[model samples]
Target: MRDLLPPGVHVAESFGDPPGAVLLPEEEPAVARAVDRRRREYTTVRHLARRALRCLGHGAAALPPGEDRAPRWPTGVVGALTHCDGYRAAAVADATVVASVGIDAEPHEALPEEALGGVALPEEREHLARLDAAHPEFRWDRLLFSAKESVYKAWYPVTGAWLGFEQAVLTFDPAGSFRARVLPEAVVPGGPVVFDGRWCVTRSFVTTAVVVTRPDAAPPAPCGCPAR
Candidate 1:
């Protein structure tokens, strides 16, 4: 179950049926480098991620190097990381016990509706258009930008295929966690891929999303998978 941390302050979500707890550190500056915005941003998010890790009984020094480009935790761990203006956070779950998990956060921003053209599929654009129409002031583009990012981080580890923002379509339930469907014929691993997600924006400037997928359901001993 997801616990609301603060009223009108933010939102958080978890995936894949983990029985463990999720920690959402209230946002605050962690580094004293007022001179370097980038450094301060890194420090803030690192602090949030560290707190999340600690909740799992792991210390900051115990975390391993992240994946080459995807949102990956050290070997033997499954997780995702993300940060937005004034906020940095992470979500982790034992892969052996919970598959893959992803989390994302982004500050509200105005985006050209046209900018979404190349990033979102035709149907996706149509769906979001309806959303934008309903809520004329909604920052749908930024929301998609964040949601797609969360999906990429979650899917990358399993498919081992980098999904372009344009390759997948995200359909949001607007007031609820959205849905993302990989375009048919899209490149995916040669097996079952479980894709399920949820999202919420408890405040006007921030949006948070989570996607948890289980290991692909495999066939009998030997259809065609190469034995590792």
Candidate 2:
């Protein structure tokens, strides 16, 4: 996962359940009513997030979710968190060097048939079909889903607008990278319309990440529309 990010970003990741992980007082409310599984995922990711923060020479801080349910990072920091069966990870960077960071992990398996229609554009599906035929070992459909997720994570913090599945066209390279071209309908003034990201498939998971540098980072003047 660390290899997926660019320099100046700090990342921490764990596989399987986090042993002895506990939530801080400020973070407990967010998961107050969550089941054990939810609590575990929440606790583990926050723990890793703080660890990444510490690596950046900052002290530990509670990461509560804002009204939008995105983590409220410390001032001067931009970051992202992700969790999936058997995996939990966090990445953070100084806002001065990195404008924003987004990362996601998913099981290395085919996406459910019904989901592909909603997640992939027609061209993206065609591209995936060709990749699948030539590189049958990779779960191209699932990797596409993960790539879009990483794009949104990077997009939302800057645009504060929803990027629908149909709003972006995606393409993949079998050599571990992908690109997302945000269509005009979803573009925001002063915000990036394209994102370049990387992907990795391990024995158990497929993970992707996007890092947008400063001068093109997020929290751009809100487009005045609520997140959908």
Candidate 3:
């Protein structure tokens, strides 16, 4: 999983075929309100996240839920968490090295056919179809949706703005990565930043990740935590 992440980032993953235990005190309230399945996923991902932080040299710490329901990391860290059937993972990086990061995992299966229209732009749909025709084995629609999710996760923290699926046009490469061009109206102060992402199909799941570094900010320092 670490191989799929960008430099300065680390990832930890777990399988859920036989669901793991839910043991985080910080997550107890949230888990108590969720159904059995959601509770299992929520707990597993948080566990993975805390472990990743530990590997980054931080001791055990509770990852509280943020205003947007994203995991709030400790100072100096920016990270993302994702979970799906049989897969749960978390990726984290020192904020000085990476501005933000987002990751998502989904079952390697077709998305619900009805969801296609709402989740993809017309251009994106056409691109997916072409890629599908070319590569026949991959579930292009599902991968596109996963990529969009990763884009949103990575975008939100930087701008604190909402991005719909149509706000960016996503294009994929045969090499298992993608680039997203922000639509004109969706441009921020950056005027339009291209988001780079990587995806891999493994262990019966498709996982996608995106990382953004602070190219425009002051030189890297260990004190800034955008996700905090």
Best by lDDT: 2
Candidate 2: deviation at residue 166, Å? 1.3
Give all candidate RMSDs, comma-separated: 10.3, 6.8, 4.3
Cα lDDT tens digits for candidate 2, 1-228: 887886678888889666877788999999999999999999999988888888666647889899999989999999999999999998888887787898999999989999999999889999999999999999999999999999999999988999888899999999999999999888899999889999999957999999998864553331221100
Model 2 C-alpha lDDT versus the unseen true structure: 0.88
TM-scores of the candidates are 0.70, 0.93, 0.89
Relative to the true structure, how large is the alpha-carbon lDDT of every model? 0.54, 0.88, 0.79
Best by TM-score: 2
Best of the two (2, 3) by TM-score: 2
lDDT string for model 3 (108-174, tens) is: 8999978988888888888988999999788888888998899888998888888898889999997
Ranking by lDDT: 2, 3, 1
- Candidate 3 lDDT score relative to the true structure: 0.79
Candidate 1 clashing pairs, residues 3+ apart or interchain? 177-199
Stretches off by above 4 angstroms in model 2 are: 215-228
Of the two candidates 1 and 3, the one with more favorable lDDT, higher being better, is: 3
Q: Which residue pairs in model 3 clash with each other?
A: none
